[model samples]
Target: MKLSRFGGILSAFTATMALGLSGAGAATAATPQARATGYVALGDSYSAGVGAGSYDSASGSCKRSTKAYPALWAAANSVSSFTFSACSGARTGDVLSKQLGALNSSTGLVSITVGGNDAGFADTMKVCATDTESACLTRVAQARTYIQGTLPGKLDQVYNAISGKAAAARVVVLGYPHIYKLGGTCIGLSEKVRTAINAAADDINTVTAKRAADHGFAFGDVNTTFAGHELCSGSPWLHSITLPVDESYHPTAAGQSGGYLPVLRSAA
Candidate 1:
């Protein structure tokens, strides 16, 4: 595992927040409710809101987007304190070593979207997009094997640590959406490759959902939330091949707000 490289419409985007990440500070008000809840967001690029634009420059390569769900939630709900520790290219070990320090007894809520990097999600997509169909399937099959065999234990370890440090926190674990719309008329790649890529997403969600339940944490299934909005669906919230290489395959700001936000909202 390694930290690797990893949005939306104009009118739909939220104003960027001055995220105080990996440190303690009072968040700007967006709600009238008492901002007493301590919230710490942790996980991979998805959690850090990479695909979504308006990233906080302070996050540097981590690309912590102000449009990310954690920042959006904190703003809308008026949390007392917020910490954005999820980083781009983060793996399970990275979560344990880098992100977990923000958690404590005072933490009221936690949310994460990890395990993709461990499964080589970004690399897998790269192979599928640029390489041959057979090569794409091979890479996907490899990811599936790793997802099924090794990812569970790594996830368990992270979940256990989250609970250990933030005993009373309501942890919400979010999963990825299928990148492509199945059986659609997307050019370049065949349906078989598209389906395989989606299957990888499903595998990750299945394992992640089970492990989240095992730890008494809520699993937010974004597939259902992202239904009819995949790449070939004509109204994709998730991005396809795009500029700034890392943004590819990740959700647009529209996906973050319209797709991921509601899922995290109801789950949290």
Candidate 2:
């Protein structure tokens, strides 16, 4: 959903009509109410909408897209203000140093998708996709070790920082979708490799969900939402591969709208 600047004007008008405010009172009435529902989005490439395309030029290399789930959700909802701070290639440390500034006590809603980068998911997938199955499995093993061991503490740091900054906001930690169709096969990637990658995705989701719960944030589980639309499915939601490589394995625009947006909306 591409939101125009006029969308805010229309929202203000609608709010005025809803309140039955007329004359001078109508102008002042809608502004404050709209501004009160502040929303901030923070995380990595997944949150920044890397594979969805139509990247926001003003957002620079961060590649924030209007088609991204967070932007779509913001456009569809009646929020007073929204800040999208997610950037491509962002790790937990990047978020701590850069994104958390967008959050504050007045923030009403927050959403994030992270930890894959920390677990070296892209590198692991590269090995699996371009190298031997044995090598890929070895990489997967390394990723799982990192996910189970080091990733949790890093996730907790980011989660705690988010909770601290947006004390009053409802934080929604989103999980990554599986890269392969369950019990299915695709070109280039063997079933065994696919299973291993999916298992890694599961590990990331499991830890993310538990950490979110510990921090008292809602975990938006997209696994079931993406059930029949994995990378190798007849109609896949996620992009299997792309020209730039960085775009590979990310959710497509349709995936952002149909897969992630609805789940996040429900949680919000």
Residues 43-140, model 2: lDDT tens digits: 99999999999999999999999999999999988887899999999999999999988787779999999999999988998888888999999999
For model 2, where is the 10-residue window of minimal lDDT?
Answer: 28-37
Q: List the residue pairs that clash in candidate 2.
A: 34-80
Off by over 4 Å in 2: 1-36
Residue ranges of candidate 1 with Cα displaced over 4 Å: 1-36
Ten residues in a row with the worst lDDT in model 1?
1-10
Candidate 1's residue-wise lDDT over 236-264, tens digit each? 99888889999999998988998899999
My TM-score estimates for the predictions, one after another, are 0.86, 0.86
Find the number of clashing residue pairs for candidate 1. 5
